[model samples]
Target chain A: MANSNTQADFRTRLQDWIPKLVLSPSLAAMLVFVYGFIAFTVYLSFTGSKMLPKYDWIGFENYARLWGLSHWWTAITNLGIFAFLYITICTIIGLGLAIFLDQKIRGEGMLRPIYLYPMALSFIVTGTAWKWIMDPGIGIENTMHLWGWESFEFGWIKDRDMAIYTVVIAAVWQTSGFVMAMFLAGLRGIDNEILKAAQIDGASNWNLYRRIVIPLLRPAFLSAFVILSHLAVKSYDLIIALTGGGPGRATELPATFMYSYTFTRNSMGIGAASAVIMLMTIAAIMTPYLYAELKEKA
Target chain B: MSVATQDTAVSTGRVTRTFIYLLLILFALFYLMPLFVMVANSLKPLPEITGGNMMALPQDWTIEPWLQAWSSAQIGVEPTGLKPYFLNSVLMVVPAVAISTVLGALNGYVLTKWRFRGDSILFGLMLFSCFIPFQIVLIPMAMILGKLGLAGSIPGLVLVHVVYGVGFTTLYYRNYYAAFPTELVRAAMIDGAGFFRIFWRIMLPVSGPITVVSVIWQFTNIWNDFLFGASFGGQSQPMTVALNNLVQSSTGVKEYNVHFAGAILAALPTLLVYIVAGRYFVRGLMAGSVKG
Candidate 1:
């Protein structure tokens, strides 16, 4: 009996240690690959690591140069345009679709899947299909001309001034369905009693939504905004697939700037600098949102 | 049973309901047009596409473009088509998804059921891993890959994806396992089942739904990834990179049919998943949004 008891005690200790052993590998990998790399990126941003990484500290020279470059300015301005329009349009369209679908319209089960199919596709695929569709000579414009609308010029894709907007169109199409789904989930979570009480108070439909339901959707709205904001900043694949930065660098986003400089242009230090900036911006958005969520759960 | 339940809050007359249906139909058409156009044009000859009649059904259907895109499409100096890269993506996705999901199942089991000190912080650290942009890791990842001698290779790309993907897989499993009954684990322990034994015999059989969610999510994400594919994948790029090359490659003439075919081929797997397991996909999304 004593021998058996000792063996059981030994086995229990082994079981307790096994989970930590299983978990440590992933934890270590995340530490080294994710956080460690972030620190390395921040460090590289300050060094004169051009062409190849040289660790000699340069004291913000890369950032200074990054700021002074016209190309960088173009990328920042385009990011501004893309992020603002992408978020605003997706939010409005998503909200509208969610409300419309909430009315219990028929064929929703089918239509909802159709709306989400694009989200299933890679941005590369989205970019290509939209590129073909947006092609002026062979696409919408040409079709319009054949229908006797000869002057229906929808060549925003080729126009340097309007190419960024074309990106917005493709991105909105790619993601609005997902945003709609999020909003629909939010709408479903609304308490029916509050809605009934509002209805009983003789409130109009618009007034009921405006006063009670919409306000009640604050968490969903905030999550959507945070999600959309980060996605906008990380907008690389769509731009690459759709516009390839543009007719004349007209749609250059920070992500593209980072890639071109890092690998293509061989301006590694500057690329690292731009990457750090992108990280800071996203961190600024994600930190508080994640904190709130984790705190609530705790 | 009807999916549409009458809502007293937004109830309206027949005319308003008809208008809502019309609005929904128009939006659906708008959303599906690109897919319709791609399918239509991929079946047509070059003349029809260049002739600017895209919205019509293909008068002369052909599977040649798909074959061309799959076997003979030009990308950069090589004209090796998307087949090799498609294989590469498959190779990368299968291992990455499987490994990450398994690790996540274990990690989630430990974090949720076998609670330990500092588990939440560790979970937070792992969760934050998914948030950092891929670009932040490019400079160091290149160095790390070189040091490990896995740079610019399929294995290296898989490593990158798996390393990053563990966070999300862990998130899914942890959330699912959090809701799991720990009493079962306790009962299994009382029976003298070892840790791995309990996991294999007890936890895994019940983790089927979440495993589907994790697999689909990881498969779609790893397969669709371009940033990692473009950066770490060597001579044989992933399908997304190859598709990008096929589109951007200024080789011969711009073959719209081939481009359309390649785009559709790249999307086929995820599209298939969405078609087949859509409810699980939507449920996966709800699980994510509800928690984070």
Candidate 2:
């Protein structure tokens, strides 16, 4: 009787502790998988880790090698070019679309979905479709030539110098709809009486938008810019799908470089260094915005 | 301040209306052009699709590509079909989204209403995790997964995705709940409701829009994933990986029609969601951005 009672008491305690115990697996997962992996990457970058995880530490050598590599330099320059152009163009285009779409026009609902449909399609689909559409011999250029406009030059995707911009175009298509939706929401939230009052002062359309509407949409722009910048930095699958970071690495971004280094070349240490560098770069860009946002919310 | 003001207001409104309409029509076309091209390409034969006249209607329209895509191109097993891949993607995505959202909501609730001593530190850690790129940890993660004997399994992929997904979903829920009034929680507590009961009875009921949003976003993200599938999932891969192999093989004489059809097949779910629940998706996006 005493033994049975002790067993029952133990069972009761186990059942009571089950809920708290359940959290242990996930907590362990976060520690071992998430935190552990991050720390491992940092440590690996300091070691001469090749295809496999190495224990021997060769401190700062990988960083020095990464700094000296031409491919890394190209990637950095391409990232700068890609980020600058893509972010700037996407923000401008997105803001314009949003401002235009905010007019409470007819068929606004129908048009909104149509614009956002690109987000539905994978970048692979877009890349393949666009590649065919931009093919010099078989695409729009050829078709136009058949229609008598022989002088048209629409081969951007195939061109090394202009290939990255093709990605910019496709990305703009994918995200501008999202930006419009955000801006439209912001616009709708604005008090209608403010616009009416502005109109009463004989403010022209351009003038009112330039002064009143633009300033009011600053929050939306900031939000869109941050998201776009993030997309730009973390770009990989899209670049791979669209150009394979090629026409000889002209379209390479840090993400793709890291991927190639780790997976293809098996340079784990250099790859980790690249990842750390990219992470730092993204942190630098995002930290200020995050702080401002938190402060504003507070 | 009366008559002149009224006249000026009417004139400016008219001008603005005209300008808005013109810009809308133009921008709408710009957005729709690529999609139109893709649709038009999907309808044509390989020869015509690759031949010329990208902006023109196909000289002869056929459903051959679609048929082939559904059958041979997308079909999983040689004898069976694309149904397996579709089911596989569904299985992976549904569980992933569901688990992540539930965990995210719990995390949010715990952080917001039931603050512990180290709550801020935990929340900060979650936030920090979002900035940690996948590239940074891919090798180590792979190694860990290998050690756990889950290197190339659906559950393993789901597990990795969930770990990555939680950060974003937590952010979403935390922001959403923060924006919500706290009086409800207090009211529930006063009415003798415990934490879990209040969450289930009160918070979950009102969290419908966010739940839908989270599900939709998560579904798309997991469904369309490529890199993880390529690295971890391998031969037991999802549709996207298979689709990549299908396209990448054979350099000469591009199979444009089949490729287009494959693209369409791959995009069907997310596209369907966006088309059907587009308003909700937009609402979710706006909410997400504003909170950020």
lDDT by residue for model 1 (B39-68), tens: 999888888899858788899999999899
Candidate 2: give the clashing pairs.
B75-B81, B75-B82, B76-B81
lDDT of 2 by residue, A1-298 (tens): 9999998788657644543443344456667667888788888899898888788989999999999999999889888888888778777777777766655457877777777788777777677767666778777788789899989889888888988888887787788777776676677666667778898787887888888878988788787887888877888777877777878888888999998898789898899999889878877877787767655654
Q: Which regions of candidate 1 are displaced past 4 Å?
A: A1-6, B1-9, B284-292
In candidate 1 the C-alpha lDDT for residue A284 amounts to 89
Q: i-RMS values of the candidates, in order?
A: 1.7, 4.1
Q: Score the docking of each candidate (DockQ).
A: 0.69, 0.39
- Highest DockQ among the candidates is held by which one? 1
Top TM-score hit: 1
What residue pairs clash in candidate 1, if any at all? none
Top of the candidates by lDDT:
1
Candidate 2 docking band: acceptable
Each model's fnat?
A: 0.71, 0.45
Worst 10 residues of 2 chain A by lDDT: A15-24
